[model samples]
Target: MNQNGSEQKHYIDQYLREDRMPHIWCPGCGLGSILHCFLSSLIKSGIDMDKVVVVSGIGCTGRAAGYVKLDSFHTTHGRAIPFATGLKIANPELQVVVFSGDGDLIAIGGNHLIHAARRNIDMTVICVNNFNYGMTGGQLGPTTPLGARTQTSPIGNYERPFSLPYLAAASGAVYVARWTSMHVRRLEQTITEALLKRGFRFIEVIAPCPTTYGRRNRQPTGLDQMRYYRENSIIRHGADPKDVDIDLNGKIIVGKFIDIERPTYSDLLDEVMQRAFGTELPKDDTSKEEATVVGSAPK
Candidate 1:
């Protein structure tokens, strides 16, 4: 390692791709902050870096996979979860993470997201919610607030936004939490907590896109958005997810909304295979049932 100042080495975890320094995020954008927190959390969690796999779909947040110094994947738009699901099912020992944005994960990829969570997949999903499609010129999105104007919602948006915390909770995520970029320590701690948990863990980070989403929504500067987060954020750790919908310039409820133990998708599958085959079925078998067919010996 080069003789660099300790301060310069901050957030430069072995899990970070330092060669990809000076990322493409806009000035005052919050992705860099979130990235730092994620790396910090990963270090604090003390997990083996070699076992980590980061996956992302196409979007601004999707760029995260490219910059992480791990087994990172930059999959097609809206397919990050499915790819991560494949990795997890194939090797139960691997810790998979799907890091993407609202548009990439909860819009076109919405069905996959719900099903993955419903199946209780063991993975960590970090969704950066900037309210609009920040990478695509600030277009209106599924999470864009009602009455908030965007490129597509120039006439003042009327469609209701998805309450992400409620969605994750209802979809069966075992660990669900929400925080803004401004909530640095709390967000990092929450990430660490999620990393240590099993089942479908979800953390929705309310971040600022000052160059796009923020500029269009009256938060002309990142500081302005941070001020809003500081003033409006209410840390109600045990609040019901049903009541956490964000409104236009309304109270923002942020907290750890859900953490419960449940059988993961892999666990249930293993149980079924064990019962049917009189033993655990190997994950590498593609024609698993064919080997167990009538009059056929188990492969």
Candidate 2:
């Protein structure tokens, strides 16, 4: 609880891992800004850290699980959602959260992502999409824009990237928002709202991977990436999903895209159990006989 009567209010220092003083992210990396917004939101929400379970996959952003001093799980690549789903089902009281990169969430875990969203699981997923895979090296990801220069795409990337926010909204995510590291306050507020929401929520943070993606693409510094965000980014709330599109050299759309209410997975599961099992299954009640072999007589 906070000193004020409000439930949301805490010192950011309370949640940080001081031992890991300096993060390994590059100087221009937008990951730090994302982390800051997350921490601030957690503090503002006044949610108990012990009740919050942060699950992450393998990537620069995935390392966030280790840095946040909470009930964290550093899971395998693209498996964070499954792990979180199990956790949420087992202990519905825990607030399940997922933090991962674009490739981790959309590429390797694409199926799981859609299924989870479709199920309307009660959890929040924070996707830090820096366009490319930064940890392994500068490689094009599902969210990487076309014509972007990466290690694998020396000439230019021709493949189109995924519209993560639009996809999530269309997939039935109850709450969906898109923001960059530049809008720290708004990002934090959006995260706070997502955390408080009931069904599956998706927040895509369009961060910058200056060390790998930036260097390869010639935007070498974090400031350069920030400038790109400032100049080319457009701020609009509740924009129509059909109107949202990102060109190789066009303005970036960032804002709250969707919010809707529906029956969550947990709620639906309980309803099914009640209807199928009639409150609870009887213990040691296997009275029905098993099937015998077609040619052999039952003994």
CA shift of 140, model 2, Å: 1.3
Residue 294 of candidate 1: its Cα lDDT? 42
Find the number of clashing residue pairs for candidate 1: 0
Each candidate: RMSD to true structure?
A: 4.4, 7.9
Judged by whole-model lDDT over C-alpha atoms, candidate 1 comes out at: 0.90
* Strongest candidate by TM-score: 1
**Which window of 10 residues has the lowest lDDT sum in candidate 1?**
2-11
- Stretches off by above 4 angstroms in model 1 are 1-13, 280-299
Local lDDT at 78 for model 2 = 96
Model 1 per-residue lDDT tens digits across residues 50-69: 99999999999999999888
